[model samples]
Target chain A: DQQVKQNSPSLSVQEGRISILNCDYTNSMFDYFLWYKKYPAEGPTFLISISSIKDKNEDGRFTVFLNKSAKHLSLHIVPSQPGDSAVYFCAAVITGGGNKLTFGTGTQLKVEL
Target chain B: DAGITQSPRHKVTETGTPVTLRCHQTENHRYMYWYRQDPGHGLRLIHYSYGVKDTDKGEVSDGYSVSRSKTEDFLLTLESATSSQTSVYFCAIRSGTGNSPLHFGNGTRLTVT
Candidate 1:
């Protein structure tokens, strides 16, 4: 069974617009959520994260919001640029669960000019 | 850059053969993980190591094995290759500290025919 799910397989947005990616999880034990950005031939890079204790966390143009009651989370990137086009993966982890991360299928984001 | 490197960026092996992928880290982090990425399945952990000579299986550990003999190296080996095992493999590391995100290596693309 997939503990984490990214319903959207792909998304497109115009430059300078806002891009939102959503994810859901079935495991209530997950206490931490993270978003990672991956280029075609590179490894995933950490973008932003939100703890279950907080409803939102923001960094620069990236913001992550968590709704623990709904077992859902979203990542928002404002003023999306061409460089933001890539595969976005949402991952979750249970605190003290040996730091094992469960990841979603991923959403391919394309920021168009 | 988290100083993570995955060797053999690409490999093609035949069925019944053995394949091993290497992951080296300069960070000396306490946690190392091996994950496989497939079309519909996101990143599923095969195995992980918490410390030198300490390891555990993850969600998909049936046909895989892992070894961590030193602080800087983690290895994933497929004892017998199969077409179903063809996928991209990623290695990740994280510090033992609180709520730290994982850093991933570029990845290794393995094709079994």
Candidate 2:
């Protein structure tokens, strides 16, 4: 069974608008959640993360909200830029145990400029 | 972009062949991981190492093996290749910080036919 799941395979948003990507996990042991962005021919790059303790974390134009009770999380990009168009991955990891990441299939975000 | 580097960025081989991918790090981080990215499957963990000669299997470790003989290098090998294993593989590294992000290498695209 998939511990962390991202039901959406793709999402589209207008430029200078808000882009939200959602993810869910089945493992309650997961203490940390992260988002990674990737472009063609490149590895994934770290975006932002939220700990199980806090419900949300923000960095620059990116913000992540975690709802532990629902095992759900969302990534929000305000005033989404064209450069933000790419595949976004949601990953989760349990604390104390060596970091074994469980990733969601991904959401291909298209920011129309 | 982080000190992580994966060698042989692309490879094509026939079935039953042996293939090995290498990940090297200059950051001297304590944790290293291997994962494969496929269409419809975001990124599945193959294996990870916590220290030199210390390793463990991840969610998807079948038909794969890993070894970390030194702190700087971790290797993933497929003893016998199969078409189903064709995918883009990535190597990642992380420190002990509970909130730190995982750094990634560009990736290696392997084709088995």
Candidate 3:
């Protein structure tokens, strides 16, 4: 059983527009959520994260909103650029689970010029 | 960018052959992880280590084994290669502090023929 799920396989947006990627989880024990960006042939890089206590966290053009009640989270990128095109993964971890992460399938984001 | 390096970036081997991938870290972090990324499967942990000679299995550890004789190195070995094991492998490191995000090495692409 997949604890985390990224329902959308891909998303496309125009440059300067907003791109939103969504994820869901079934495990209530997950207390931390993170987003990672991956380029072709490269490992994933940490992007932004939101704790269970916070509903939203923003950094630069990236913002992550967590809805604990719905067991869902979303990543928004405003003014999306070409460089933002890549596969984005959502990961969740239980607070005391030794930082072991459970990952979603992933969503491929493409920002067009 | 956490000073993690995965050796043998690409490898192709015949079935039943044994293969080992190496992950080296210069950050001196106490946590190291091995993950495999495949199409439609995002990233799944194979194994992880918390300290020297301390290792644990992750969600997908059935066909793999890991060793951590030192804090700076973690090794993942496949006793016998199989076509089902062909995938890209990544190594990640994190501080011992809980809730810390992970930093990853480039990756190693392994193909079993």
True contacts kept of each: 0.89, 0.89, 0.75
Across B40-70, the per-residue lDDT of candidate 1 in tens digits comes to: 8988999999999999999999999889999
Cα distance off (Å), candidate 3, residue A91? 0.4
Model 1 per-residue lDDT tens digits across residues A1-113: 99999999999999999999999999999999999999987888999999999999999999999999999999999989999999999999998968899999999999999
Backbone collisions counted per model: 0, 0, 0
State the fnat of candidate 3 relative to the true structure: 0.75
DockQ of each: 0.91, 0.88, 0.84
- Name the candidate that leads on DockQ: 1
TM-score of chain A of each: 0.98, 0.97, 0.98
lDDT of 1 at A36: 96
Please give the range of 10 consecutive residues that has the lowest summed lDDT in model 3 chain A: A93-102
lDDT of 3 at A11: 96
Candidate by candidate, in order, the iRMS in Å equals: 0.6, 0.8, 0.8
Residue pairs with backbone overlap in model 1:
none
Whole-model Cα lDDT of every candidate shown, in order:
0.95, 0.92, 0.94
Question: Which 10 consecutive residues of model 1 chain B have the lowest summed lDDT?
Answer: B35-44
Error of 3 at A15 (Å): 0.4
